[model samples]
Target: MEDPIFSPPLHRQRHQFVIDFIKRNKPQKVLDLGCSECTLLKQLRFHREMELLVGLDIDGATLKKKMHGLAPMSTDYLQPSDDQLRIELYQGSVTQRDARLRGFDLVTSIELIEHLTLADVERFSEVVFGYMAPVAVIVSTPNFEFNILFPGKTGFRHYDHKFEWSRAEFKSWALKVCLDYGYEVEFTGVGEPPPGQQESVGFCSQIGVFHRLGGRAVCNMMFCDDAEDEFSYTLLYSKNYPSLHDNNILQRVLVTEVLSGAEKLRRKWAEETNGERDAADTQAEGDWEERHRASEQHLEMEEKQTDVFLLVEIPSSEVEISVNQMDCKTLQQAEQQRGFWRSIRKLRKKICFGLMAEDNRSLGKCVSVPLAVLWSGCPKVRALGGSLSNLRQLLMDHPGVTLSQDGSAVLLNDQEHEEEYDDLEDSGYAEARQCSHSVEPEEDWDANV
Candidate 1:
């Protein structure tokens, strides 16, 4: 097995290039071909929104162990927990094994293709390109000519490898494959081809970026002889990607990569921290007020929203608010929702409301309204919007407040409360509104997952 840990400086350069390339594609479901120990996937996993991450390797036992350790870290793109990003690993050879994988946004074969025979390469490409999700396929192999740079560091080309191609040979083969499969191919360098002849510049390990056309395979066959004959080469596969917003491809790629990476890190950290947390530990940790303030600060930092509209139905209420189309309170409730925190879109300000009244007893059964709406008179007092007899009494003595029941709902129609919220937002006090009380210990952490 090749030691990725000791990867030569050149190989590391190639690996980084591939990582950046994949990040550009923004794949949802990723198939990691010839995944050894899955370190690359683990690192890359945190930088993107992943749906299903499947790792394939010939070593079943190692793959199993890796998967077990990762299972608890897996989560929905919106609610990734440490345990939910568990990668599914399969043991099988690329040539002899069938992944039955289709619709993958990206397929990667890093330093794995060099070990195959001509027949094996054909089979490997067929399966990879056939099932690829029209977005991108990245295949990297040792640049045979550049092996001169490392005297004793030739790849797995002993008796196991049928043949290895120079950069030009690999590019030629790639071109033929792309032509037959209908994929557009681009070449990327791994490690700089040590300063040498002009042609040697492209002589490092060859990375073929295969872009599937409309989800269809393009190339049928690429001959080694043909690759040897071609002269012109292009960097079509240079790292670039489309953005939902207008920006240069490189800028969008960087921004998206950072955003996804940050999210993945938070999820990974949360998973690690959440697993070991205990009631006593949390109780004994930091000052309650300070931690609460920190949590609120964290929340505010994440308050920036995406353009996409999210509809969240309050657990007990029939009302579902479109975070983009809601009142401030609804937006606040949306903010408190778990998914809302993970998404970084600017929410549209339209909120949808629904009223649920099963009977007189269930009038104010909603749990989200109280915390979302502030009572003006008492900064601490929040109206849950129900005419509970107990609440009515609390407000009656607390003049300048009205808990008047309107139909089946009790409106915490306090002018002072509204005024304060207005003032808070207008004067930019909202950002300064530090939580006055300690955030309750997350009693629901272990209970939720």
Candidate 2:
């Protein structure tokens, strides 16, 4: 079922031409003119620059059967995206004028123009070049000039092809379309000619790249659903992919980033202050001292200056961003910092020395986290296996924490601090627990300390 002359198959080569075109011109909104089984649309979905990807085919049933592959993947939740993308499949003819198909950044028709009759081909030219007038258009069809290179091929390459055009004939029609529609055209082809046949034949498949002049195509058809009678396209599938712009995703990014940062900071602070003490604790020093000195006797008599740190865990509920809590510029920077897909590696620390630092500061024994900063932009708050909100509410319901009178901040009485944080004695928290060997996402703060 494959031709040796083309080497890599003409259809695949055709698709590659369009894919390269997309890479060169990162069009926000793109429409596939004759999307048969949506093979090209499936490949185009991976491009993050593609904001709106629409596939149009006359066969609704075939499209419905094939579009399942275009749905969001399960792995998307493990990793969230900031790119705004929407994919849609609609059943329609390129010959007919559909208001929804107007003003696209690019329009593509691969090996499809040959499938239409001579009359429909004229209509296709008018609808695509004159009516739907995208910024750029790519059309590929069989090059009749290359037929001589085929061994046993007699008629057109495919039975569905109405009339295959020679290189000259194809160029004549493309140049006429540009002249009639105020656009410029460039001719190119894929599937290199076999050895020693380059002079006679051009290529297995020919392509035309059309660019519209006079700036961008302006259309008033976005909301023009008034004439329902003329609309030929039937909506098949539509989905708004989860993006970082969403409050839920934003909260997740913020929560994960802050938690991860806080954990690293706490680890560094602990390592610097109690690196030797941590080794002692791991060597049964804590348990040994507890048994030997009866716990409080040794801590109060010799090791007393070191105090336990405080980390106020936020709620699990998706944070609704507020101006007081964080600004848009901060959120953008946070998103840019990760530069990775999904929360593969996060801090997720439930106990840190005051998680956020903004206008709020630690007062005395109580370390305060601004309620605003706590619910910072796109902060997805989770702790260990359990939720941060559940444990936070649990602590609040109990005598574990206290709130400021104005409710602007959450003052955690759990964190017992001295007048100064720097030059503090060996960390009591590190001395008691040692290094974070048992760092779990769902561990409760009360039990952790």
Candidate 3:
């Protein structure tokens, strides 16, 4: 099906122009002002040029809903890359001064200025230019002069438009903005003109590109919000979900291996107990019954099992970390939990091994290392700093045991317990890896069929 976001050729044309402009400029950081429904921002998500994307809007509810709806799909095409593009959404007015909005390379406001009052327009220009101080800014608005071409059009194009400006009005405002903010401005138009009308005077929309004057070309700032209250702004989605067929296969294999191993161990212990009982019966007739009871108790104790719980923190959104508790009874159970972590690892490129501790004052204490030190998995990772030295040491001690090239399965080596796991290696264990990564969609894209 055609993407509903790209319908209506006017908006699509505007979005394409902005996207093309960004591609040419190759901005590392991009800010989308008044990102309603995130239609343009969604298209920009696929672009590899942007390292960080920030979308701000005054309608907090709409922004939240749109972000949630546009959450990444479970496709390999959307898999996280080495550079790891980060997308963030914020609920706030563009006319206001926000420290979070500062330090962007390019800021885009598409069909947004017409909704604002003239006073808000001046404030928006000041905040974007004087405070945020991006190297480049692109703004687009409806050209009232072109409205005459529409046969029945009367007043404003839309009910929400505070005002629309003619080409001359837009150019005059843009030039004054450039003069005030020490920026060089360029003018452009979108849409076809009437047969008799000049292209400049009859286009449907007007665009202005503002280039900042001499200063530092780049600046770095923390784009992720860490405050507990800021979690509402983050967008999260899970990918690489396991299918029912795959889950059924995995269940059958694990059950067969576990039951078989348990039965073998039980029989071996029973045989050893029988030999001892026979010897006791011959040596002492009175103690035979006592020894038999002790053997039965030992077997019963071996049958009982305890569950293990592990607290793991997974990267969820740009600004939030998802903490999950993994519950398992046996080694196989623990291994089953690897699928979730593997997906996260693939998206992030390198998985950071961290020490998770329970704390009374806070939610939990997590000491995580940087990605560079994490991938190397060396003892020198401790020197990088933070209270994560213990985690680095643990990783250094076990090399290539937990994390693998495919990041699907973890191998445990225990010489004493080799016999117990002999069946596991042969019982279709590698099949679990297949379920961890992207799988072909069950449905075909051919709508006609």
Candidate 4:
């Protein structure tokens, strides 16, 4: 039976190209670089004519699960297949040349080079050409210049791709590698270009085939003592930070101190304001009752007098005293009303303080105290009225007030106090200073004031 007709899709084209090349050359042994999960290797396995098929990858677990009946072997112990067709899986890095990689008839790395960092590309070139020195090498990569043809494609084909090369750039690098390694090279496209194009601008994918001129291989291929160190593992794109135990402790201490100070200031202000109101109320009530008793005695004297003139005079003074007492009583009631409102305001402030304290506790878990303080404009502390100025001064005089290497405030331990922090400069401090000016006591205090 003849081979099935494969579609001309970009991905299918790549596999077809490699299959055709393999069928024509009929290499005895073949190596596949970055053979993850053996997707392409499984396709290649259909051809039983090849005596040896070696799949190399960094992930041993993946190869074990994917490549059936292919036992894992140490890089040093890898041997070419003696049977009619044998598949071998070697867990290793292509960037590092191993002696086992030598004497291959063909080497194929499909869409692998773009995943490597620029620094690793040089090592990869040396390993494939200067070291393995296969009879033929085939490589494929995405054409970045042709990416515009696809709708809504923003960046590289894959997030893991460190860099993508244009057709011209790929040709330039491929030609240089062939020239340096004494190989004749050819380039081809895997996808059709846009319609109405007279010349070949580029392709969605680019392929290169390199044929060694004399099949002369270099020795040892830059022997690496740590050649066993694999580069085939997944790259972690996100940053990792050490646990924030120390920072958490520092934040807790700072928050505790701030809360304590704020409570004290609130208590002091409340006591002073309440005491004045209480004293005024006591004085007004006492004076009003005394005048009422005096008015009663005057009325009694007026009732005992027989002359109407004396009665009228005494009643007038009594009436005047009664009015004065009424005014004092009204003043006392006003003071009581003010006290009630003051208590209400204080209650609101207490509630706000509790909420702010909870916020501080949560903020401590994620950020250092000084950075949080600066970021939030010290809202909780500022809500302490006149105490805000004192807190600002305290922070300024604090020995631990230093900026981190990243310019955020660093909550230093006591031992780190003597260390110089001249390298730490924060432009944010200026913005923080401006923000602090706008930080007034919370609006709850307006009712009391």
Which is better, 2 or 4, measured by TM-score? 2
- Cα misplacement distance, residue 87 of candidate 3 (Å): 1.4
What is candidate 2's lDDT per residue for 285-380, written digit by digit as tens? 344334424433433453432331212222331111111222334323443443211120111122133332232334444544554454442144
Residue lDDT tens for model 1, 1-449: 23432356555665577567666765666777877777776666565455567777776667656654443332333232322232456666665434245556677888888777788889877666643334578888876776565556656445566677886688788988887766888777555544565375464567788887654232222221242232111111111112222223223333333233333444454467445644433442234335435544544565553222323322232222122222444445545654433221111111111211123223432212221122322221222213244333443444333333432222332233234334434542223222211133332211221
In model 4, what are the clashing residue pairs, if there are any?
none
The number of the candidate with the highest lDDT is: 2
Q: Residue 150's C-alpha lDDT in candidate 3?
A: 73
Taken over the whole model, the C-alpha lDDT of each candidate is: 0.49, 0.65, 0.58, 0.58
lDDT by residue (1-449, candidate 3, tens digit) is: 11232235678888999889988988888999889898988898777687778888888778767776545556523223334466778777777776756778999999999999999999988888877879889999988987776767799988999999998899999999889877888888677665668654666778998888763343333234453321223332222222212433333333333233334444565467557655543444334335435634553455443322222222431212211221223333534564533332322211111111123113322122233333244332223213354333433344332323433222222222233223333444344333322243242211101
* lDDT, residue 430, candidate 1: 29
- Identify the leading candidate in terms of TM-score: 2
TM-score for each model: 0.45, 0.63, 0.50, 0.44
The predictions' CA RMSDs to the true structure, in order, are 24.8, 17.3, 23.7, 23.7
- Candidate no. 2 TM-score: 0.63
lDDT of 4 by residue, 1-449 (tens): 00122245566788788899998988877889988887777777656457678778887788777766343334212322222555667787778767666768889999999989888998999989877778889999988877676667688878899999988889999988988877888988677666754155576678899988865343223343354532343321111111112333333344445544434444455478657656654554466547646645664555543221111121112111011112334334433554433432333233332322345434332212444453355454453323544444445444544434443443433211111111111222223223323433232221222
User: What's model 1's overall lDDT?
Assistant: 0.49
Deviating ranges (above 4 Å) for candidate 3 = 1-8, 76-79, 218-449
